[model samples]
Target: MNYDEALSYINDKSKFGSKLGLASIGKLLEKLGNPQDGLKIIHLAGTNGKGSTSAYLSNCIMEAGYSVGSFTSPFLERFNERISLNGRDIPDEDLAKFTVKIRTAANEMIEDGLEHPTTFEIVTALAFLYYNQEDPDYVVLEVGLGGRFDSTNIIRESLCSIITTIDYDHINELGDTLEKIAYQKAGIIKKDGLVISYPQKEEVVKVLKDVSKDMGAELIFSTEDIEVVEKTDYGSKFNYEFNGIQLNNIKTSMIGEYQIYNATLAVTALLVLKEKGLIQIKNEDIYNGIFNTKWKGRLEILKRDPIFLIDGAHNLQGIEKLSGVLKLFKYKKLILGLSILKDKDVDSMLDYLMPLADIVISTEVSIARKLSAEKLADKIKKYDKEIFVEKNIKEAVLKSIELADKDDMIVFGGSLYLIGEVRTIVNLL
Candidate 1:
């Protein structure tokens, strides 16, 4: 199959839906010779910051002269962004090749009476197969959903399991309560393995501690060991201590107060990796990696003249962080373009962002699950009376630009799908 055909074939598996268990993936991997086995993995699971944390670690490892594979989800521009090696996306030819092999294995699994693999499961299997073939020194694996039964959890152990801030997300599948969500995220902690985490809520902390104790895993907290010395829109300067060694003035290019915690977690995980003798990396490499790491669609500035910014703040926590960051910018007016998925907490997210906008333009992405622009406008009317409905994302962006002045700021967010569409329309990708 060709690249486009391969993508279509894989996307067609969406008819199988998103199953959360590892059975089908495990069976599929077994058919593919269990490619996940013997891999040194840095498995990460959380509601947010997973991709940023994964980017920081993978870049650091790669800078240390080691081959690193990173697997993430919900690509902003292309499907190839989901699977990358040493900062380069999977080549089109390799993607086609892996799809053909995995498609054959999937067919055999169905022939053996196993259920058809879900799209996420097939993609996970493809990543494992690709990384296995490449034989990278380390693979940074981010969970697609709740970690316990996630297909990526098929790996029995990891070099280090990192759990970023856990919050209410995918509640329909993970659970409704914070403790339940924390339990699901904590499932990535392997028996007797080292686990690193960002500071979590009180309930989340209890759940993580309990799970770590039960699993016999050593738990380390980044919040307790890392301190932010200074922060700005450009980045942050921080200090971290590990094993009685104090490292000062650690810097990162990822801007946001919360990103300080994510960067610190990445650094801490890498330090643990170094101590375990799994990899040798100097402090200079760590510093360079942090400074060089970039994760798109999170408070990204697309244009400076009209001050256009786009962020993928689809959840409550994400929206809260975005709102906080917006406070630091000086603008004459806030022109907002927003869209969200049906399953998100739209009311709360709207409540958080609507008050900050002078004029709101509601829009929907091309995805089937996206909330209609009209319905979203209705939801926003409660918070802000000045709401405009544009069903097309591109039109919504154009409308936003028309309403904004040079000193005003135009911010587009609510869903990654929405931001992706606008990014493509604006040629920011």
Candidate 2:
């Protein structure tokens, strides 16, 4: 099969629709010899910061002169962005070959009366197979959904499990309360293993502490031990202390003050690996890794003249973080372009976003799951009367630009899908 055929085959499996269990994936991987069995994995799960933490950790490990593989969801630009080896996406030819092999294994499962794997499960299986063949030294795996039954949870254990800030998201599947959501995320913790986490709400902290005690895992809260020495719009410099060893002047290219916490989580995880002799990463390598790390679609400044920025703040907690960062910038007027999926808490997200905009242009991504522009406008009108409805994403972006002066700022986001489309258009312009 070719690249287009491979994508079609994988896309066809989406009809299975995000089955939240391990049975199908387990059966499929078992048929392929359980490639995830003996590899060193760093499993990450949370409502926000998983992607950024994965990027920070993987880049650091690769800088230490080790081969690293990362598996993340909802690619920003291309389908191949979901899996990478040492920062490079899997070659299209390799993806095609792996799809052919996985397709046969999936067929066997169906013929044996087992359920068909979902699209995420198949892509995860392919990642495991490819990593097994390539034999990377470390694999940084991000949970596609809640951690407890997520397909990536098929791995029995990980060298380290990292959980970023837990908040209310995916409530329909995970649960409603913060404790319940924390339980699902805490599921990635293994018996007698190590866990690194950001400072969380009081309820979330209690849940994580209880789970760590029950699992015999050692939990290290990164936020309590790290300090942000200095920060700017470009990056941050921080100091982290662990096991009586303190490192200062650590920097990261990823913007936003919240990223300091994410970087610290990555550093804390690396220190755990160091203590266990799992890898030999030095302070210099950590410095370089943090300095060079880049994860797109989070407060990314695409242009300077009109100050175009795109962020993937699709949920309430994420929107709050984005709002905090936006307050640090100066602009003549804030022109907003927004879109979101149907399942998100749109009302809560708009509550955080609508007040900050001088003018809001409601738009929709070209996806079945998107909220219609008119409906989004209805939500925005309740908060801000200065709202415009533009059904097309590109047109909405252009409209924002047309309304903004060189001193003004145009911030377009609410969904990663929207950010990806807007980024593509901005780059072309």
Candidate 3:
């Protein structure tokens, strides 16, 4: 098996569709000798900020001079990015090697009258196999979906579970209300474990508190004990205090107010580990990690003049955050490019973004779930902004550049898939 073959084997499983249970993943892992067992895992789940939060934790731990392995979803650029060791993607040869091993196990499952593992399950099993072989000091596991039954939830234990800011998303599987979503996010909490989360709505807090109590897990909300000393377009200077760990005059290059919550959540989790004597970490490690950790495609500025920015703000809550940032920039005009999955709340997202743009171009990604460019343009046409349809993503991006003056800003967002494509094109240009 080779790289292309590995991708084909995994992508072929997508036809089986997604499932929200652990039975298949559990059985599949059992055949693979349960590589997730005894691994020090920091499980993360929520609607937004999980990736950014994972970045903080991974970088902080690695900064403390330890090898860290991270498993995240929705690859921004390459399939290899789904799993990484100390910020480097898994080698292509290793991915192909694991795919061969997993394929055998999957076929055996089918022979025993069990369903084939979904694409996420296969990839997750691959991650476990890859990490277990390398034996990193820690594994930062980002849930592929809702936590309770997400493919990554196969582990029976974790060092800690971190829940980033939660909002309405994956409603078809998770649920419609914030409480329902919180319950799913809370599922990553193991019995008698430690859980850290950002401050949330009252109802969400109640749900998390209830779940923690029921499981005998200790839950701590990263208290809103933070003050923004100063903020620039690229980063912020803030003072944070919680659980007697005070970080004053800390700087982070990640933009937006929500990232402060993510960093704080990560810091709170780190402090808890330090108190329990789980790992050796210091204030300097925390400071360096927070200052240097980077997650691409989230508020990334591609160009200086004309301000070409791309963000992975796919859902309503995410778009709301992006809109908040857009209001602060001084520019001649806001040229926006959008492409998102059909399953998202299109109307709500457009409602938040349409008003901010002087011109809107609706384009489509290569995925089957994407909303067509023409249809997306049709929806934008109802709004007051001048809209265009460019089915070709490259053409769509080029048009945005052509329309923008030296002082005008161009923003390409709404989907990670879209952002990845645009990032490649912009880099080459």
Candidate 4:
């Protein structure tokens, strides 16, 4: 199949979506010769900051003179973004070629009495296949959802498993409470392997400790001795003082106070790798990688004149972070365009955004599970009855640009799909 056809074929599996099992993925990979076993991976899992943490870790690995493969989820601007090597997205021809091979393997699985692979399972298999073909020194893999049953779990023991901060997302599949979510995220921690985690609530921390003990795995809590000194719009400066471990100046390209935690996780993972004698990473590599890393759509400032900002702050925790950042910019007028999954806390998200928005414009993207534009506008109206609605995403973006003054900001986010659409409209690709 071609690229578009491959996309359609893979996405069609969403009809039998979210099987929540590794069996299908395992079988699918077996048919593809289990390429995941040929590579070393720093497997990352969490509700938020997983992408940023992965990006930070990939940068550090690259700075160590290693060609790294990065596999993330829910592409921001293109499907190719989900897979990358040395910070470059997978080429279109490579993607099309791999898609056809995986499709054939998946069909064989179905003919062998196995269910067709879910969309994530197929993508996961494709990543393993591509990464093995390229033979990168390190692969930074981000879990698509809760770790236990997520297809990405099909990998062998990771070099180190890093769990970032967790919050309420995919509640049905994972669990409701923070402790339950922590359990699911900790599922990626393998037997007798190294696991690194950031500071979390008491309940989550307790769960991690319990699970770590049960699995015979060594768990390193970053908050046990690390701290962030200060933060600005550009980056953060911090000292990560692990017990009898390295104390150094760590910097990250990702903005926001929470990114400090992500940097700590990445550093902690590197230290774990260092202890294992798998790599000899330097403090300069950490500093340079942190500054050089780039993961888009999280508090991304696209243009300055009208201040076009795009963020992937879809959940309550993410929305709260976005709200905190929005408070810093002193823009008088705000134009907003948001498209999100139906399962998201739309009302809670609006509670944070509506207070800041002067003109709230709503629109839907091309996702199958996108919340309706009219429904989103109606919900926003409940928060601020004067909000406007536009069904066309590009039109909504242009409307925001039209209404904003030079100092005003046009903030578009709610889903990565929305950010992807804005990138297309603004020719940011």
Best by TM-score: 3
Q: Per-residue lDDT of 238-327 in model 1, one digit per residue for the tens?
A: 888877768889898777888877888888888887888978999989988998998888888888768888998889999999999888
Off by over 4 Å in 1: 13-16, 225-227
Candidates 3 and 4 compared by lDDT, better number: 3
- TM-score for each predicted model, relative to the true structure: 0.96, 0.97, 0.98, 0.94
lDDT accuracy of residue 420 in candidate 1: 75
lDDT of 2 at 59: 90
**Cα RMSD, each candidate:** 1.6, 1.4, 1.1, 2.0
What does the lDDT read for residue 179 in candidate 3?
A: 96
Clashing pairs in 1: none
lDDT of 3 by residue, 1-429 (tens): 999999999999353577768999999999999999978999999999999999999999999999999999888878999899999999999999999999999999999999889998999999999999999999999998899999898899999999988899989899999999999999999999998888888998999999999999999888889998876678878999987778998788898877887888899999889989988999999999999988989988889688999999999999999999886578989999999889999999999998889999889998888999988888888897788889999999999999999999999999999998899899899
Highest lDDT, which number? 3
- Arranged by TM-score with the best first, the candidates are 3, 2, 1, 4
lDDT of 2 by residue, 291-357 (tens): 9898889889999878999999899988998999887788989999999899999988888888889
Scanning candidate 3 in windows of ten residues, the lowest lDDT window is 13-22
lDDT of 4 by residue, 1-429 (tens): 678887787778453577866888888888888899968888889989998889888998899899999999988777889999999988877778988988898889878888888888888887898898999999999998899888888887988888888888888888888988989999998998888888788898899899989999988877556567767666677787765676666776677877777777888888778877988898788888888877788887788887888898889999898878777576778777788778888788888888888888888877677899988887887665456678898788887887889988889888877887787777642
